[model samples]
Each structure stands twice: as C-alpha cells, then as structure tokens.
Target chain A: MEEIKKHVLDCSNLNCPMPIVRIAKTIRTIEVNEQIEVTATDPAFKADVEAWIRKTGHLLISYAEEGRSRIAIIEKTK
Target chain B: MEDQKLKEYIDALVEEKVNEKTLAFQNQLENIQQQLSTVQVRENEKITMLVTSFELDKVIPAFIIANGAASFGMDVTLFFTLWGINALKEKSIYKGKNIKEKMITMMLPSNPKSTTISRLNMMGVGTSMMKMMMKENNIETLPDLIDLSIDMGAKLIACQMTMGMMGITTDEIRKDVDFGGVALYIEEASESNITLTF
Candidate 1:
C-alpha cells in the first residue's frame, strides 16, 4: 500500500458558506491532483462540498461522518 | 423515353436540395446550442448584489455572501446605493460643502462599525448587545468581514448617483471602493446567476 500526503483544513464551528469558502480558497494553494481533507461542524457541509465539487469540476475522493463533524477529502482536478 | 429521363433528373435535383437544406438547419441549431451553453457557464460563475440598507444586520449578510461566493471562485459584485453607501464610508467626519450636506453626513453612520440594526436599535444599546453576542459566538465582525471580502476579490462598487444625491465625495469613501452608476449595476446583474438585494 502507498501513502498519500494530504493538506488538512479545519472548519469547526463555522456556519454555511464559510466551510465551502475556506475549502475553495485552500484548494487553490495546492498543486493539481493534491488532496485536501476538510472537517466541518456545519450540518450542510456534505451537500455544500458536493455541489462545490460538481460546479468546480473537482474530485471528491471520500466523505464520512464522525459524530458531529462531516469530513470530505477532495482532489483538485484542474 | 426523354420524358421519363427528364422526370428522373428533376426528382434527383429535389432530393439534393432537401438534403442541403437539412444540413444547413443542423449547423444553425448546433451554433445556437453552443452559444446557450456558454451563457450558462458564465451565469453559474458570477453573483451580483444590490445593498440598499445600512443596517448592521442587513449589511453583514451582504458581505458574508459576497465573501462566500468569492471563495467559490465566482465573480462577486456588491453595488452599494442609497443608505447602503454608508457601509463603505470612511470613519472620519467629512466636512461637506454646505449645511445640507453637513447635516446629511452628520445624520448617517460614519462607517460600517457605527451602523445599527434596522429593528430594536434602542438608541444603539441593542446594537451593542448584538455585537457582544456576535463576538462571543466567534462570528467575524462587520469590519473584518468587509476586509475579508475585499481580500477574497469581491468587487465593491459605490453608486455614484446615490453618492451625489447624498453629497458624499470620493474622499469620504474608503480608498479601495469603486464608484459607478446604475449602468454598472445593470451590467453586472445581467450576467449574474444570483442577484440579491439587501
């Protein structure tokens, strides 16, 4: 098995649009094909991230729920 | 035999003309489809807002949305008109040219920080309480949100007509604010997928 390095973004306690906005901003600082792991407490995190990925043509590698936090691993395709 | 040959030649010519016409129509359809798709892409990539209120609660959401949209890589524009123009005013007191202008300046909130909520202002007491609550909740303050929006590339456009009517000078506004008229707002709003008024 191979290990992949990922950038982590913590959006705990942030409301709507903040998590998505932060994620969008963070994705730009990394290289193409790099992955970002985002953990957010906002309930809409899953849907927001999905829509963002769809609109921006990015890749969502995986998503999960750990208690109150919704986590998403996204890859910058472009 | 000559009549039969003539009839066959006319039929062949008609078939060829019909095929040519069909091909031309298909090309036109494809061109229109391509144009439509381009417009959709542009619409999805932009957002425009008309901020017509100076109330703290209303103005805060405007900046929040602007910052959020900018984060999503959308072209965001905030068109400030009328009372909303106060949100971009400099904190310093402006000495107007005449008494009326001076009164207007004195009456309006000096800047974003001084703005009070539309309801339950209670002579600024409620506004203070709300500010305290926001601070406790870890929400970004209005001034910080405005700065964040600008840093995120959200365009802040002050309505020139409103500024003139209110006797506000370019020096009274923040340095980074852009000044424009209704035409600019329409130009931005026309291409935006989401157009909001606050």
Candidate 2:
C-alpha cells in the first residue's frame, strides 16, 4: 500500500469557529490530496467540521471521538 | 375548397412558428435567471456588521460572528461607531485637551477589557463573573476575540464622525483599524449579504 502524507492539527479545548477556521487556513497550506487530522475538544466540533467540509467541498476521510475530544481526518480535494 | 385549405395550412404554419419563438424566448429567460442567481450567491458571501454599542454582551456576540464568518472564508467588515468605537481603543492612560473630552474619556471604557455589560452589571460584578465563567469554559476573551477577528482578515472601520464628536484621537485607537464615515458603512452594507447592527 502507498503511504499517504498527513498533517496534524491540535485544537484541544477550542470552541466554535476556532477549529473550523484553523482547518480552513491549514488546508490551503498543504498540497491537494493531503490529509489533515484535526483533534478538538469543543462539543460542536463534529457538526461544525461536517458543515465546513460540505461548504468547502473537501473530503472527510474519517471522524471519531476519544473521551471528550473529537477527531476528524479531512482530505483537501481542492 | 382549395382556398379554405390553403388558409388553414398558413394558419397552422404561423402557429408552429409562434410556438417555436416562444420556447426560444423562455429558454433565454431561464439562462438569464440562472446567471442572476449565481451573482446573488457570490454577493452573499460578504457580511457587514455595524457595532454601535460597547456593552460587553453586545460586543462579544459581534466579534464572535465576525470572527466566525471570517474563518468561514467570508469577507467580514465591522464598522464601529459611537460607543462601538470604544472597543477598538487602546487601553492606555491619556488625557484630553478640553474638559468635555476629558470627561468623555473618563466615563467611557478605554478598551474591550474594561467594557461593562448592558444589564445586571451591579458595579462591574456581573462583568467580572461573566469573564471568569468564559475563562473556565475555554472561551476566548473579548480582547482576544477582537485580535483574532483582525488576524482572520476581518476589516475594522472606525467611524470618523463619532471619533470627532467624542474627541477620540487617531492615536488613541488601534493602528490596525481604518477610519471611515457613514458613506463607507452604506457602501459596505449595500454589498453585504448579511447586515447586522449591535
């Protein structure tokens, strides 16, 4: 299997727009098809990430939760 | 009988031509409508907010929305006028030349940190309690939110007329803020898809 390049973004304890905003900004810096694994503790992070991905037309590889932290792996398609 | 048949044939031809023309016109209209809807979507990507109040509750929501929109890749403009201008002021000890200006400076909060809530302030106790709660919840402070909004590319425009009336000098305001008047606000608000007053 080919190894995929991925980046990590830690948004622990951040709420609302912070996680989404940082994701949007970070997506621009990486090359297309690269993945970003974002971990945030905000309760709304999962829903916000889904909405953001829908609006921005990105691909959500996977989303999971660990304790209080919500994690999402998003691929930058554009 | 031949003449009658000829007349009927001509009428049928005319009706068919008219129907074809009408269908073409309708298609053209649909294309134009699609183009117009696309333009509307593009224009709606911008948001303009008019902040006229300096109360902590009001200020927090304004910045939150502004920052949120900015983070969402929307163009956000925050126009500060009257008491709202105080949110952009630097927290410093400066004296005004005239007594009225001095009094105004003394009465108004210097910056977002010192601003009081609209109701249940109880001599700053409520504001303090709210700030403590926000801190405990990992929520960003008002000052931090303002800075983040600016950092996120939200345009901050201070009302020049209000500054003149309140005797707020340019030096007292943050250097990153742009100064404007009512005309500027009108221009931004007209182009924005969302216009809110706080």
Candidate 3:
C-alpha cells in the first residue's frame, strides 16, 4: 500500500457556507494524491461539510465528534 | 577616483532602467487599448434588479439595489406591496402618534418572527430587538423605508390579490401606493433581467 500524506485544517470559528468554501479552496490548492483533515466547531458543520463533500465528489474517510467541535477527514480524488 | 567613476556609471544605468520601465508601461497601455477595441460587448446587456415585498432586512437590500442601479444608469424599480405597504404609511407611525401602530409594535414580540428565526428559541425576540435597536439608532422602520422608496420613484404597488385575500380595501392602503394585479407586475417585470421574491 502507498503511504498517504495528510494535512490538518481547523475551521472552528467559521459559519455556514464558509467552512465548506474554505475546505473546497484548500482542496484545490493541494496535490491530487494528498488528504486533508478538517476540524470545525459550528453546530451545522457535519451536515454542511458532508453535503459539500458529496456535492464536490470528494471522499469523506471519517467524521468524529470532539466535545462541542466536529471533525472530518476528507480526501481529494482529483 | 575610479570608484567615483563606477558610481556615476551605476547612476546612469539606473536612469536608463527607469526609462525602459516607462516605455514598457506605455507599450502595455497601447496593448490594452488594442485588446479593448477587438473585444465585443453585447449591445443589449442584461441587468438584474431585485423586487422586495418583505420588511426591514429584506427591504434594506431593495433600497440599496435601487439606489445603486439608479446611480449606475440602469432602469431600477422596487415594487413594495402587502406588509411592505405599511412602510409607505404616513411617517406618523414613527412619530408615536398612532396608537394602533404603537400597539402593533408592542405586540410584535409575541408574533412569529421572520421565517428564518421562527425555529430558534429566541422566537420573535431577535426581531423585537431589531425594531428597538432601529428606533434607538434613528434607522427608518419598515414604514419609513417604504416612504423613502416612494420618494425614490421605486414604484410602490399594493398587491390586489394579497389585499383581497387579507380583506384589506383600497381605503385602508396608503395614498402613495398604486394598486395592481399580478399581470401588471408581470408586464413591468418582463423587461427586467432580475426579479426576486422576499
């Protein structure tokens, strides 16, 4: 198996549409083979981020709840 | 002596570099002009204009758009109707003379707020707070905004259907408003590139 390089992203203070927008932008700037781990605190982050991930045809490896914050690991397919 | 001569030579080279940059900028300007000449913009450019029937947060954008479009030389019309009609009501609402208006303002905290905040715990509290804040800030309430819209030729039209549904009559509506049906609105909006429902 090939080793996957990953980057961590923290978007705790962002509101609706902003977290998704920032993540999409970050994904575009990364190399095709790398993955990004996103962390956010907004209550709507899970559904919002997941919806965006599905819409953009990206992969959501896993999502977890950390206290008030929610975290998701996503991979760039392109 | 030789060092002094070298410094003079460097100064001359810097002056020549500056001249070269100026020429390059001039050349870039000419290139831009050439590109502009070849670039064709459509004769009939579509412009988007918003039509708002809601109050305050919604109406503010309409006013801003109308002012912006008029300033930009675009044909802009904002049609105020229904509750928006109250905005055009006599400025006396803000003057505290109308007991009915005062009662409605006092009772607004109990009514359902805008659709966006109805599900929240604060319910109409946010809207109530907004109204109070506007009064304190000397911001025009919904009625005053309607008056402003009228003064700007924003085309305040009371919806015949809405008024009929609400059992409101022409006598009840403010004097500045022109009553119209959906067909008239559609006719006016036909030439518009932008139409928004608030």
Q: What DockQ does predicted model 1 obtain?
A: 0.56
Candidate 1, B46-138: lDDT as tens digits: 899999999988999999889878877899999999999999988645564577778888888988888899998899899999989988767
Candidate 3's residue-wise lDDT over A1-78, tens digit each?
Answer: 989989998887654434564576578789886898888877888887676665566789999998977989889887
For A1-78, candidate 2 gives per-residue lDDT tens digits of 777889999999887767887897798799999999999999989888888878778999999998998899999897
How should the candidates be ordered by DockQ, best one leading? 2, 1, 3
* TM-score, structure 2 vs. true: 0.82
Which scores better on lDDT, 1 or 3?
Answer: 1
> Which candidate do you rate higher for DockQ, 2 or 3?
2
Expressed as tens digits, the lDDT of each residue in B1-198 for candidate 3 is: 999999999999999999999999999999998888765532222233334344456566555555433322345555555555444343222242256555544333211123122233276677677767656644444444445444434566767766554444565556866787767677767867666665
Error of 2 at A64 (Å): 1.5
* TM-scores for the candidates: 0.82, 0.82, 0.39
In candidate 2, which residue pairs get closer than 3 Å at backbone N, Cα or C atoms, i.e. clash? Answer: none
Q: Cα deviation of B6 in candidate 2 (Å)?
A: 29
- Cα-based lDDT at residue B78, candidate 3: 52
